[model samples]
Target: MIINKFGFRSNVKSVSLSVMDCSAGMLSISLFKDLLKVHKNSVALVLSMEVVTPNGYNGKVKSMHMANILFRMGGAAILLSNRKQDKHKAKYKLQNLVRTRLGSDDQAYQSVHQQPDEAGKVGVSLSQELLHVAAKALRTNISELSPLVLPYSEQLQHGWSVIKQKIWFLAGQKGTYVPSFKKAFEHFCTHAGGKAVIDAIEDNLRLHKEDAEASRMTLYRFGKTSSSSLWYGLSYLEAKGRVKKGDRVWKIAFGSGFMCNSAVWKCITNLDPNLRNSWSDRIHLYPVEIPEVCDH
Candidate 1:
């Protein structure tokens, strides 16, 4: 949870994405995206993350072990600016994104479920089918966002094919089609849900190992911080001084309800490498490849 410390509680409406899955990272970023667009020229402070142990299930042996190995406490705070005048100082531009929710099946939502057992110990269980749900949701979201961002040539060819087949219904009416995301954004911050989730997305998006390094590192360093993981991923880029003015970045996260949320952002300032945070501080102790999982 991120909050403004301006000494006025009433002025701030604490926005929280609780119990959100890995995709919450994207959802929170999308919220910031909307806020920036509405307030144009102002800065929006975004805080996101999750504390999963409080809801852990103790009786379920397999589930509890999985949770123990997969989750860690982590969060992040990011400042976003949308002012066009700030372009000179801006680090990146808000690009295009597509969000989609597939609640057609209750099972998909239940794939990664949280509940209590007979012993009253709460825990989360990830069904073997959860990955399938994620893949389906991602496919739907990409199909919707691809046409809009794809190059004109690719769009024309794909558009004509869809039109000829009366398959416009497949992409929907919003024109969500986008060309390869590589053409529109310089960096990618995928939610650090877990190794499997990250691997799945990397394969699906055709992202290079370097493109996913930030996310993987954050997950290894800080574990799954839920909605805030995406910001941590971005911070990795900033920490390395990789983000430059006018660069475009894309953030993607997954969450309950089997939803895929995305946000596109352009940097407004050169991030300070010396910036400090509870999360980043811990990164120093982490191994570059994979770190041991410790209970917090």
Candidate 2:
């Protein structure tokens, strides 16, 4: 419909995908790369939209109720091209992408699911095991992604730590080292799914509060915009003038079916500090104190 509305040629191609919410952005980039392989100099539009307002459920189920509190209606779009003329003006260059899925496991598969209730009214369900499943998915994704992004020194440290942790396990010990991804990427665009999600990522990665500021602020301002949440986080970094020329950025997201996807990008040039973005009007008020919310 977009292509038709734009009055594009009939030969222009389009594809729609629904990989849950979080990983859709990276998945769209992967799909665009595949299109480039088949059609040289191809231009692709990656669009992500989530309409959670209609999915809101008023039932008494607590887990299901959280979704209404977390998700919000939002969308984002990006244009990609292999054309020589467009390359000069591109903001960033894709470096690497890694995806992990644990759908084979029953718990992982149903961690975040949509189904009917006792009254046969359907709604999205959030399992108590959702966080556990997300952690597993992230570990699997990092295992595949670390080698592609982390420097050699960090990799050696990470490898030695894993071995030490295994040996410690045999000796009845219970601690493991967390390698610093900050050494690998200058900026991180973690999914702004919710406050809890942001907290978990920061804790697991041993990241400083400033490192997670963009994600936290994005969540506070935008709620959980589903797949587009990562973009908002990245936009936050840009708006703060944190991203620099030649800097590497790590974008990570989690979706239903226990999927974790990551994308690495290198900034092509230094971005203007005053770059207008979604948060232009209120960027000054952000990095604000986000107090803990306990529902007990």
Candidate 3:
């Protein structure tokens, strides 16, 4: 249909994927980078979408129940290319992408899975243990990501902080120091899955409220939006003009297969406020106080 509408040749090579729900979006971009790297000057179009139907679930399990409340309708198409000519119009350039999967572990793979119970009823059961699995994956991913994105000075400081914490640990001290990601990134587009997920990231990263305001506002306005929440948060920042040339934004997400995927992008040009986005009409209404519970 895209080719029919856009008048592209019918025989263009294309690939489609299904990579563990929320991870699908970032994984597609990861594949895009590899394709562009090998094919020289080629362009790749990555499309992500999720369809939620009530008929799919009839169980009252925690995960299945939450899914209806969290995930909303979303779809997005991203164009990526290695051609130098396309750089001028690009909003951001990919810097680093890290994908981690804990599928090897039974707990991780089973944390959020569709399974049948005693009466032959199937539902996606979410274990509280899911948080532990996700947090572990997050730490491993960030441990590798920090050095690539953090400035030299910040890296040195973080290293020394780690050394001190280790020394304190050996001295029977009950403490741990987590490096601040804000020192490395100007903006963060955390997956707007839920308030708890956002809060866990903020706490672990040692970020200030101003740093998390975009994510909080994104969650408030858009709910989960699945993997596309990253763009929603980015749009919130772009809508408020927080993103500018040379700024770095991090996109982080977690998926059902107990996957943690992250990508860092450097803004090449200022985001135009007038450019088309979902927040055009009510951006001013955002960065507002989002209550914990919605009362109907």
lDDT of each prediction vs. the true structure?
0.71, 0.82, 0.79
Candidate 2 lDDT over 99-194, as tens digits, reads: 888989999999899887787767788888988898888889988988887788888877776687678456554565567899988888888877
The model with the greater lDDT, 2 or 3, is 2
- Predicted model with the maximum lDDT: 2
User: Which ten contiguous residues of candidate 2 have the minimum total lDDT?
Assistant: 168-177
C-alpha lDDT of residue 161 in model 1: 61
Rank candidates by TM-score, best first: 2, 3, 1
What is candidate 1's CA lDDT for residue 284? 55
Pairs in clash, predicted candidate 2: none
Of 1 and 3, the candidate ranking higher by lDDT: 3
For residue 242, model 3's alpha carbon misses the true position, in angstroms, by: 1.0
Residue 122 error, candidate 2, Å:
0.8
Q: What stretches of model 2 exceed 4 Å from their correct place? A: 58-62, 166-174, 294-296
Q: Tell me the RMSD of model 3 versus the true structure.
A: 2.5
